[model samples]
Target chain A: MTNVKVTPLTDLHRASGAKMVEFAGYLMPVSYGSILAEHRAVREQVGIFDVSHMGEFVIRGKGARRLVNDIITNDCSRLAEGALQYSVMCREDGTVVDDLLVYVVRDDQVLLVVNASNIEKDLEHVLTFDRNGADVENVSDECALLAVQGPRCRDVLTSCPLFDDVREQVERTAYYHGFSFTHGGSEILVSRTGYTGELGFEILVPSNLAVEFWEAITQAGRDYGLVPVGLGARDTLRFEASFCLFGHELNDDTSPLEVGLGWVVKLNKERFRGIETLRQEKKNGPKRALVGFELEGRNIARQGYTVLKDGVEIGKVTSGAFSPTMKKSLCMALIERSAKGTEGVYEIAIRGKTATARLTPLPFYRSRAK
Target chain B: MSFENMRFSKEHEWVQFEEGSNLVTTGITDYASGELGDIVYIEFPEVGQELKSMEPMGTIEAVKTVADIYAPLSGVVREVNTVLNDDPGIVNQSPYGEGWFVKIEMSDRSELDGLMEKHEYDRMVGKG
Candidate 1:
């Protein structure tokens, strides 16, 4: 068996009695106590997630902004300093390489955080740009990342004296925005961004200080209902929010336009790598549209299962699970727009038997706004 | 609990033989359910279907993974817990009571001899 690489916090996860599993080439915590408990903890209070496996790259030098703007589908020029924008890094065919967050730290420096599995490919793609204008460095190994997510996250984090002044700053920062702060005498970057559709922050710190930082936050947030969450609940939470995972919802073959992420793509901007093909796909409409569905029966639809209409196979489920929050089996399917009839009845082939399913609107569950 | 009266299988299934009717009620053990968290779906075999000992009879889909439910004795399925259609979480909540997967009419009474008792099954699972 191939050995999965452990994060710098693996020992801490094990000491906390986390159930470790291989996910995206990293041996990460799947749960600490229970999946449902962790799921609820993040929804109701605050949860700390060891997301250090995510890849981070630093792009610096003159003309760095131009190089970044040329590669990603989103218009980065509109982003002010100290802001973050969600965009899809795509190939020339308009197929997504990965959906990533771009942090424009300064005029000459930008930080791109990508999915763990696509790090090598993303770096390779970024390096293909003319090296004479910009320098790209993969700094994923040097940094550790943690997400303090939920409604109570701000209260839990602001207790740290180092973040006292910055807490006020983060309060004013809107969603998808972030700023830098000093914590424990260490300068760290805190972003008001997360995959779980809740008010949260993603903190980037040095790898050596990760365990100390994690313990400090967990201890301070204990009375406030903060729990250390694992990857299991993280997956379910993101699925409920209809966020795209790299291999499941978004892949090298799936375009942003096909998955209802067209808003992130900037076609009006002068020219990017995938602009022409994306423009054509947008005008003609994608052949297959990714849609959310709720199974009527108890059977859970899984990946690669055929989605049938009137007993004829029309499409296939890409990502599916039992939504812990909604108490319903939910799935995302890529189906031919023609076969997506207005009728609510659809069948999912599960173990050779067809189970009834219905096309629900995207986001099977929504959080109560704070 | 009468330990000698109940028989178990290596797959963590348990069966209690009814004295005169020659029928048996089968369910996965508590240990099995603890390992498979929050069963969301259960596909049970239809009534009247014959099953061989140690053979795959049904499938249980949990929140995280899927496991096969195996038959503990050679028998024909007499009844299934139809309530599982709406409340599959019963498997996680009570694996031995309302979560019983099936009732079977025994094809051979001697099949029980091949299975383990509670003590042996517990020993095999490292809990004895």
Candidate 2:
């Protein structure tokens, strides 16, 4: 227990009657009240999440852009200052190391936001690939992240007087773009990005001021029916959106091409890690494909459940849930590419019984993010 | 119908035996419902299905996780509260009252002697 960590807002979550659980070695809130209610609040009204468990790293120096582009699949060189691009870093074998968001601060300074569980691994990967001696520092311990999400997210954000200095910029910040603002003696970064398929903003605050910033956002969101969401709702929200969570949709053995993230590969660009294999896979297609499916009934198809076609094992489930928004049992599975000819139907082995599941479109829920 | 006389299982199910009849009513405890967060679906055992003591009887699905509902004693399922078919949240809202999962005709009434009281069950779950 001594090795487990707690985010800066953990005490406040406990004070608000949140049910806490261990996730990625941190004792985080699973829900403040009901996960179903918290999920609806984000879809129908607004919600706030303490996502401070995510990792942050700042890479600076003359070789920063090159180091980033060489390590990640996306072309960071194309990003304008203040722009963010989602990308996956892979080993030479074309398997993913981590999926991250790259924030371009300047031509020579960039920030990488990574998965909390992969901080140590990602840091070591970046350092090892830093042929140009780029200064890479893990700032996760000093940073905290908060996400305010919903259709009325902008209204809720601008209502906070603390954001007066950047209210205009906040309203103008395009999707995937960010701007930094300073107050008192500290600085914060605000970006129009989120895991939920909702119009939202993620704010990177200093660890010391995380609670204060969260309180300000919560106060401003009260009139708009903002609920304090937890990790349980966070996962269901992203699952409905079909977002590829690192461990679920990707791992050291899964390539970006197989998980439907090929758009970020940018094979036409300069050589990067795993480019040779990804380029080859692009021409021949990946061996496996990720597809969305809905079960015939309410029974869930849990992660790692065996997927079968014609009574033969095809693959396994990656993520599954009873989507509160869709009101159905849904899952994403990684199946053999040859098995895609099953005529849109497959069988999922659930609790020792075969349950019928049918192929559905990628996202079961439509995004109102724009 | 007071829960004071109800016996609880180590698995967090509560069983109430009628004084004159062999019929027993059972459901998950309030602590079980609270730990499950928001229940979205429950796959109840079919009527007339035989249940063995401490064996899995059904499935309870919440938004985050799923767990098996275990039978507290040996019996045959007499009836399932079908209302839970469309409104599983009732389990989270009223775990003791309307959320009762099933009624069973006890196979061995002597099994009640091995069950725990509310206070002991609470102590086991660190609620006492």
Candidate 3:
């Protein structure tokens, strides 16, 4: 096997006593101390995640907005300057290429932040958009992103002089909005969006300043109970929020509509690639839908585990874990629409044994009010 | 604490042989439980089942991943710690005592000669 790539903060993670593991070809921290502890830290107070592995691309030149709009599912023209929108790029067959967050930095400048695994494909897709007076460049290697997320995130950022001028700007910047600011003598972009379903901010800074900036925020937020979270908690937190993961909940063969993200698709707008297939799917309905469930027993259903009803295999688990907050095994699955209403006890084929499971609503764990 | 009489395997299993009854009480070592995280479920092998050394006897599901429990010696399953069905967390809290997975009637006591002692197992795991 090829060697896994290490981020700039690899030493920091090791110093913090994080349990490092290979994930998506990167040697990343899976947990700092304990998965449950890190998971709870994000739910109650604040947690920081090294998200430098995600890909970032810059689209410049005139007609950039039009070109980007024609490529993505979301209507890019609707985004005002300094706003960000979540959308999906798709194949002609309506399958998702990648779900991305597009930032409208200026009328002619757009930034696309995509999943780490889909960087190459998304870059190729953007290049296929006819240019139309636009120039797309992949800038993933030059930038490092960090996420400080939780209810107490705003309070933590208040102490940084780098964020002082943008404090009010960030405070008022509603969800999915971003603003450019100077941090530690470097230009930084702060976005009030996160995948954890909590109020937080994502900061993009120069790769060189990543370690210094991470240490500064972590030290400042210590009193507020900010822990250096790892990808393990990141997955659990996102799973609890009903967010989709790249290969598990979504893939090149799964469309946004099939996963309950049809709201981002603009079917009526000027024709874009994959419009015909998506329109047809919208009318016919997806064959399978992503649904959440809470297993009755402690048996943790995992990816590729078969879901059974009445002793017959009906579907498969995409992502599953024992939720720290609820203290129960929870999962999300892509099952046939007909299996929706079938109640009573279901089973998950774990190993060679059939363990009983139950289907509950999504967001198995809800954040408590402070 | 009397691990001198107990034999261990590289997989972190410990077997304590009862001299008189020729029975073995098996449990995972503290290192195994710590690495596996909180134990959420434990599937025990049925009584009267014969198990070969190094063969999988049952499965243990933790919060992060599922691991198979291997037999440390050739034996016939005599009893299982049924309390684990309701309180599987015992494996994380007290693995050596109440977290014991099964008791077996030793079929081939010579298998113990192939297993490592606590000190040897520790050295193999780089913890000695």
Candidate 4:
């Protein structure tokens, strides 16, 4: 509990009866009530989450695009101003440093949103390319983020009076795009992006105005069934969508190619970190492949649970949960690629006993997000 | 089933003994259920199985974590609440009523003497 950071919305979350927990050095809300209900709120209607704990770094200078392009796996040079690209930064050996969002703000400025836990490590990693002449600054503490997500997300946002000045821009923003607008003399950045498999917008406001913005959005969204969500439902929502969580699916030693995120690795582009290794991996295939599965019954295959084939261990579960939307126990595991076969049954060792599981497609739930 | 006649164990389980018989019903406390969040499944011990005082009897699986349930006293499992198999959330809703875990036919009724009464258990859990 000592040295744990609190976001500006901490008091508000406490007032709403949130169950707070320490995650990645921050005392954040895991849930306000039942995670199932909050999960349903996002899938069926709309929900808002205080995701301010995530790290935000701003890179600026004439060498900004080059420095960013030289570090991440994805091609950011093709991005138009105001566009966002999902990418991963890798070590020299093609293993992940972190997965992040690259926001192209201007020709000379870029914003990188990364996992909260890797702030210091990521900052250090980025500073390695300082000789490229780009100025790297960690702006995580100065920013507060809110993810307004669901099928009805746009409707609730448009109806909020606080966003009256920016309603038009918010409505016209395309998926994976963002725009900066002034609301009541305060700068706000709105992006049509989210980790949840739902139509959503992630709004960024100054930390000092976080409480004001949250209350305003909540007040306007009350009639639209907008519930205040927490990290618990955030994980479940992302898990159901088969999105890769950094610690779970994309650790430092895990290659992007092995985790089904190969699309972000543009080996054909100019040289970047791990280009040689990733190109070799792409040609010869990775040693391991990430896959999803469904347990036969109520049995849950928790993280680090061994995945076996005929009593021999082949892999381990990276993430598992009783899917609130699917009502079935689901898991994502990284196993030896040679052992993969969609038709075969695998056993997941849970608390000494094993549960039978069947291999399924990567994304267990398809999003209704346009 | 009244609180006055019930005794609690340190493991957050409550047990109520029948006045004239050795039959005792046991389940987790409200605080335990609340802390566990949403209980999705429960692995109950089989009927007729003997258990020693404070021995592991079963496990409760919630969304976030799993917890082991211990036998409050020496007994033989007589019955289990099958309703939990279909809707484990009942444990979160009514932890002491229909959500009862097992009915044990006690072998040593005097073991209950070491258990805490309602007030003491409440104080131990910070309610009192």
Candidate 5:
């Protein structure tokens, strides 16, 4: 295995007694003290996360807009400048290469933020297909990101003296909108997009100023009960909201139609990778569908666990956990659409014994946001 | 917290075999809870169910991982702590008292001989 890269907040996290673990080639804190405590902080109050390991690619030059439009599933033509969009890039066979957030900085300049584990593959995908010849640069190591998320996020950010120049704009910014804020000669891009199903802001700044910015955010959020949450809570938070985790819910084998992400694929985009297959699947409603389930017993149906119907294997669990908020064991599984309305029930094979599970709705939890 | 009269297993479950008594209480160790991060669920075995030594009893679900609880000794379960059904977090807060998993009627007194003492268990966990 390669050496794990350290984030800018590594020493600070160690000082706070965080349990660090290897995740996506980065040595990141899984939790500080308690995963439950950090998870609650995000749901009830506010929490800050050091998400600097996420990769960013900058595309600019004459045909940048055309190049980006050709790559992603979301309609880039509809995006106003400074607007953010959640989209996916796919291989020719319609399987996901990576899901990313596209920040339309300008008509000819775009910033694509992708998952940390897929950075190399995403960069190669963009660079390999050089139809438009845009200057694409992967500057993941030079970027630092922080996500301030929760119900009280705006109030806490508004109270921060460090963000005074853009205080009014920050408070007024609508969801999926991003704008530049200048701090000490550097332009920090703050967006209203977040993985957690809550009102939040993701700030991208230069790596050198990350420490100072982290301290400032922490100082301002002291009155709002904000804490530094690690990736452990981050997973549970996103999972509860039914977001598609890269390797778990989504992978190179599953189509967007199977995971309920077909809405992002613009069928009228003229031409793009996997367009025909995605269109065909969308019309026929994909052979498989993703469904949410509740395990009747305390045992959780984790990833890769076989989901069965009448003792016959029909699907596999994608992601699952005991929800801290709901106090129930919830998970999402990918099953054949033909088995959708099976009244018998579902089961997960656990240690040679079959554990009963109940098929439920799509998402186990929904945020207050529309 | 008093392991003086209690015995432990390498799987991290603690057992207290009373003198000349057939019933003994069992609970997961604090070390196990700390390693699991947060206790979200504890599947208690049904009372009167027979379990074998080192065999799987049920399961312990945490936020990040799910683990199986092993029976420390061969016995028939007498009672399961129902308090954990309402709030499994109690296992993390009080692994020794209210967090106890179950009580079992030992089929054989010699089963306790296979269990480890406090210091022995601690050494096995690298905490000694």
Candidate 6:
């Protein structure tokens, strides 16, 4: 077996009898009790996920915003301080390097969060593109993140005493914005942003204090039915939100345009990596567009399953599951833009058998705001 | 039938032959259900279908993964769990009781020789 890494909360997850799986080199929990229950906890009440495996980088110095904007496809120039912008970095070929969140710290500073597996490559890419030699520090090993998500997330967090002194600030942090608090003499950052469509917060803490925060918050949310969710529920929640997960809807071969992320690409701004190519793809439209589908019955089409039209290969499923919320076997497939004329129905090959699937919107479920 | 007399397959299925009879009832083992997580769907072989030894008989769909339920021995399916159609979570809740997937009539009495007893199956699954 490959020697896998473990996050700060690995021991705690093990103590909770979580099913651990190797994900991005870290031994992360796939589920604690049931993925379905964990999924419902996030949708109906609140749930927490130890997303410490994600990578973090701090960029500072003059022109940092401009330089960061020059690297990511999204427009960061108009981004206000204390706000986070959904962004992606692209290679020169217009294919995605990684989809990330750019926390605009200030005019001369920003923090970038990337997929855990792409830390080295993303760091190298940013450093290579740093013409001014702006300070870009990788803090992936030192940081831990917990995603507290759902409609009751606001209440759960506001009730937690971890940062009670800044309770008002925590409660008032606007969507996509964050506030810093003092925890054990170290700066802790919590942002009102998450992959789940629910009103949620992503708390970033020092690696040493991850467990403390986990315990404190889980205790505070006991009445709210907060549970320690694993990566399995995290995926289902994000999938229902139609969030683009790297290595699924995005990769080195897939452009933002193909994944319905054109909204994040600021083509009007000054030249950035892949600008010309992405602009060209935007004008002509991507060859394929990501779409969601449901198999006619109970069968599921997992990642890389073929999507066919008229007995011919058309596309492939990127991510799929028996969605807990939707109560159906649904999947997101990147089909040829021409597959639209297939009359809303396509076939998925599951275990060598052809199952009929019909096109649906990207998100199979949306949280009904209460 | 109690779980004490059950035989297990390497694929994580449990079979218990009725006392002094050809009929045997089968279901996924507890270890199988634990590994599969919450079961969302189960596809059962039709009643009266011939099931060859160690061959694909049906499928078990969990929230995260899907695996084919294989026959542990040569047999003919006499009954398939119809309750799984409306409430599949029973497979995870009661893998040895209400969750039994199929009842089969043994085609060859000696086919059970290849199966593992509880201790052996537990050892194979690394629990014993």
Q: What are the C-alpha RMSDs, in order, of all predicted structures?
A: 2.6, 1.5, 2.9, 1.5, 1.9, 1.6
Tens digits of per-residue lDDT for model 6 on A251-361? 889989988998999899888999999989889988999999889888888999999987899999999888888788899999898776646458999988989988888
Best by DockQ: 2
Higher-ranked by DockQ: 2 or 5: 2
Checking candidate 6 for backbone clashes, the offending pairs are none
User: Which lDDT value does model 3 have at A306?
Assistant: 93
Candidate achieving higher TM-score, 1 or 6: 6
Please write out the lDDT profile of model 5 over residues A1-370, one tens digit for every residue: 4888988888898999999999999999999988989989999999999999999999998788788888988788768989988889887888899999999988888999999999999998988676566899998999799999999999888998878888988888889998887888888999998877888999999998899989999999999999999999999999989999999999989898889998788878887788988888788889999999988776777899999998889999999888888877788999999998859768888667778888878677786432
- Model 3 earns a TM-score of 0.90
Candidate 1 recovers a fraction of native contacts equal to 0.47
* C-alpha lDDT values of all predictions: 0.86, 0.91, 0.85, 0.92, 0.89, 0.88
All candidates: DockQ? 0.55, 0.86, 0.51, 0.63, 0.80, 0.84
Q: Model 2 over residues B58-109: C-alpha lDDT tens digits? A: 9998877789999999999999999999999999999989999999999899
Which segments of candidate 1 are over 4 A away from where they belong?
Answer: A1-3, A160-162, A367-370, B1-5, B17-23, B45-52, B76-90, B93-100, B103-105, B118-128
Q: Model 1 chain A: which ten-residue window has the lowest total lDDT?
A: A361-370
| Window of ten residues with lowest summed lDDT in model 2 chain B | B1-10
Candidate 2 chain A, poorest ten consecutive residues by summed lDDT: A337-346
Chain A agreement with the truth for model 4, given as TM-score = 0.98
Which stretches of candidate 4 lie above 4 Å from their native place? A342-345
Per-residue lDDT for A70-181 in model 4, tens only?
9899999989999999999998999999999999988899999999999999999988874477889899999899999998888888898878877898789999999987
Q: Compute the lDDT of residue A71 as modeled in candidate 6.
A: 96
Residue pairs with clashing backbones, model 1: none
**TM-scores, one per candidate:** 0.91, 0.97, 0.90, 0.97, 0.95, 0.97
How much is the lDDT of residue A311 in candidate 1? 81
Candidate 4 is scored at a TM of: 0.97
Cα deviation in Å at residue A22, candidate 3?
2.4
Off-target runs (Cα >4 Å) in candidate 5 are A131-133, A342-344
Q: Write the per-residue lDDT of candidate 3 for residues A263-312, one digit (tens) a residue.
A: 89999978777999999998998888788877776778899999887887
